[model samples]
Target: MIFTVQIKVMPLKDLLDPQGKAVMGGLQNLGLNNVSDVRIGKHIDLQIEAENREAAIATAEEAAKKLLANPVMEVYEITVS
Candidate 1:
């Protein structure tokens, strides 16, 4: 069967996200002071053919680890539907 896989890739909390910070600064400039912080990340969707949800998640996780996300600086979450 085919599964819909979603992966969220984000910079580690301990690491600084320049893009997020830049956006935050822009927001502040626009008078959006209520927003205290921002974090930028990537959302990836994949259609995977697998026997089960678990297998689909595994495949998406491998894709996240190998190419989608940089493990040294980022973390990823995988969900299968």
Candidate 2:
């Protein structure tokens, strides 16, 4: 069977996000002061061929841990469907 996987990778909450901060600064310059605490992350989508949903989720998590995320400074969330 084929399953669709969606992975989101982002810096840990305790870490600083320079890119996000830059965007927030830009937004503020544009007169959008209501925006606060902006964050930037990566979204990965792929199709995996697995025996079941559990296997698919496991494979996706492994992929995220090994390649998609830094594991030390970054965290990741995976969803299989």
TM-score of each: 0.95, 0.95
Worst 10 residues of 1 by lDDT: 53-62
- In model 1, where do residues sit more than 4 Å from their true spots? none
Q: Write the per-residue lDDT of candidate 2 for residues 1-81, one digit (tens) a residue.
A: 999999999989999999999999999999999999999999999999999999999999889977889988889998875
Global lDDT scores for all candidate models: 0.91, 0.93
Q: Top lDDT: which candidate number?
A: 2
State residue 20's C-alpha deviation in candidate 2, in Å.
0.6
RMSD of 2: 0.8
The residue-by-residue lDDT of candidate 1 on 4-71, one tens digit each, is: 98899999999999999999999999999999669999999889999998888888878988899999
Query: After superposing candidate 2, which stretches have Cα over 4 Å from the reference?
Result: none
